[model samples]
Target: MSDPTSPIGWGIQLAKLWTSSGQTFPVRVKDIALEVTKARFPEPVGCVIPHGISGIDGMLSKRQKKKDWCISYDETVTVPGRINFTIAHELGHFLLHRQQRDTFQCGQLQMLEYDSPESRRIEAQANTFASYLLMPRNDFDAQVDGHELSFELLGHCAERYETSLTATALKWLEFTTEAAMLVVADHDEFICWTYCSQAARRIGAYKPPGEMLPAGVLEEIRSKALDARKFRRVAPGVWHPSEEAIESVIVSDQFEQMIFLVRFPFALSVDHEEEPESDAFSDLAEKIQGLR
Candidate 1:
């Protein structure tokens, strides 16, 4: 493995810590930070404060007087899931990047912004640390064992991990065998981000971050209201404007944010998708065309 402080490697350290102490799942991250910081470092984290941090989700710095390390966050972020993610993110900065600099301030989009490779890499490291610390790989896989994929299963996993639906879904996609995708958008119907599973990428499910919402959605969806369709099978181009893509998509309306969980038929589909011009799937096509 690489260095223990690397994004993937840090997970190994966290896993070791979790297992050595009775293998607690959905680990109590903040408490662990307080315990581990003092145990593992010369200058321990003095505080993890959920207080006013004007423009950022989380910030890491050193305090005055004794000048110990401290974490600051926007106390206004009400959702427990978001708050937890933010703090864990700062802990990531503390564990991974503190040696590189004295202070680290991060906005919600820092990791996802992708403005520069170096900046994105560090931010992504923080996110990975947070994800692995909260949801261990073995525990997550055990939860999904023998169960087929669905939006409801994702909801249950999100509840178990105490993270947001989108965060947990993204984490699930990171390790799931099932094909999946998550698209998040703001209240103005703007695309915040999009994720394609390793399986889905074969058929080219990738989309740029700022693409507009496509035309086939209902008015309520366009308005970004809350109305989720559990699992609706749709033809290609409903979400993506491609002819060779079809998906079983789940739309969850988290008020302004819309999450679409698109699952494809098989990982092997892309390998077999290159077929002759003849309609080998004509019967299937006729059934689908009838719906329109």
Candidate 2:
């Protein structure tokens, strides 16, 4: 095993572990894990149980000295995609964090959780691992390389990759060349979090924390409207405090709150000057997103 601490490295190694196929989708990861552990370690993973925990999304057994390991997850997680991510996350701990901690406990889908700093760090790594594993960049980029991101394009990718829209969108946002951002808000309209791509951030686009979602976006999600997936262009200082016009897309029917996927053309300067950074927005994006 390469044993790289970086999640992207670990994910690449895991994807190539199977000898018979190059395809990453529909990966029987549990089987590969069992085979690898049995071959590599004295204390190999032995069994996987779906009903071992309550309220918890997934967990790994306390480490033992002599070849005893088990993987377990909440049996009641009806969303197969979520369970798969949880399992992959546990496997990530097994590969990446096992030496640091004997057991791993994971919660249901969440973000920006207040926990010990160490635990939170590992959680982010595991999330990165899961995201990369489930949606390998090679295949994902093929589907989304030049296409403008809409819920439709992302929804199809989600079905193909067997992941939640949030996960899929996050993965795509990680590598997009387009100037785009994803902002999550709560039922009370408080901004939960936001993620902007390298291009978006470079163009000096930002949505600060604690700001309310635009009334246009709030009304779109609340309307029980199925046909609301087009560009909701906003002026410079609405949802985003930028000089450029932002094209926004509201993910509808999301119960209480909504998400806005905003995009705009990159900006240029005559003097080729770099925009000053927003310390507050930088801090906010560093926090985890997709919270619910």
Candidate 3:
């Protein structure tokens, strides 16, 4: 091991070990968590269990009377993908931040915060660790080699990795060659968040939260009942001023969210301007304030 100190470094090291050991798809994070802690610390993780915590995905805390640690995930998270990722996330905190802090509580929104000026460093690191550990880059790329970037394809990847579709799409965006953006909307139809691929960001294909669904696209989606059977060529003026995009939507009943996957036609020129960062810390603080 090449001193796997950072999140990505540890993720890579563990992922390689898992692969070398002939472990199959959808890495069993629970086993890895225990194995890792036991090898590195006398106070290894004593338990990875469930809790009925509200408004949070997972937590890691020191034992009350002992030096050991406990990792607890939300019992209400029925989705296997979400549950698996939450366990991996808590393990990341145990490995990286246990010496610095007594506990860590993470929410879904906080897990998605990464590579931004407003992102919490440790939270972002844990997220990166979970992503890389759960979905190793080499295997993920191999899975994506011949597939078109679509919800159907990403859904398959999600199944293979035992991760949520959102997480899979975000992982794809991390290294995709296509100019695409993944926009997630709350049940009320407001754009709650978005992640853009490198190609998309180069052409300034990004949207801010709190915006309504793009004009006309919403009506089309509603008419189709969010089937995702075909992509509609939305005109330049809809999603972006200078580019046209093909759009598709998937409605997730479990999460009560709408996911829009948009791919732009190749751009003739690029935008050098950048989007301003949101008050992410303040927003996260407000969300977790009730717990305090």
Candidate 2 lDDT over 157-265, as tens digits, reads: 9888777776777777777767777877766888867887767777666676698877766665578553425765566766556545555454434345567777776
lDDT value for candidate 3?
Answer: 0.77
Ranking by TM-score: 3, 2, 1
Angstrom error at residue 81, model 2: 1.6
- Please name the candidate that would achieve the greatest lDDT relative to the true structure: 3
Off by over 4 Å in 3: 109-119, 268-292
**Candidate 1 lDDT:** 0.64
Q: What is the TM-score of each candidate against the true structure?
A: 0.78, 0.82, 0.85
Off by over 4 Å in 2: 1-3, 18-24, 63-66, 109-114, 216-228, 243-255, 269-292
State the lDDT at 13 in candidate 1.
Answer: 76
Task: Name the candidate that leads on TM-score.
Answer: 3
lDDT of 3 at 274: 64
The TM-score measured for candidate 2 stands at: 0.82
C-alpha positional error of residue 77 in candidate 2 after TM-score superposition, expressed in Å: 2.0
- Candidate 2 accuracy as lDDT: 0.67
Instruction: Estimate, for each residue in 1-292, the C-alpha lDDT of model 1 and write its tens digit.
Output: 2347465567657766877788555566677677888887878788888768665778888775666788878878655477677777788888888878888887755544436667666776777777777777788888888976766786787777777666777777776655567666555666666666666655667555677766655443546533343445565676654533333334434354556666666435456354332211111121111100
Clashes of 1: 0
lDDT of 3 at 261: 92
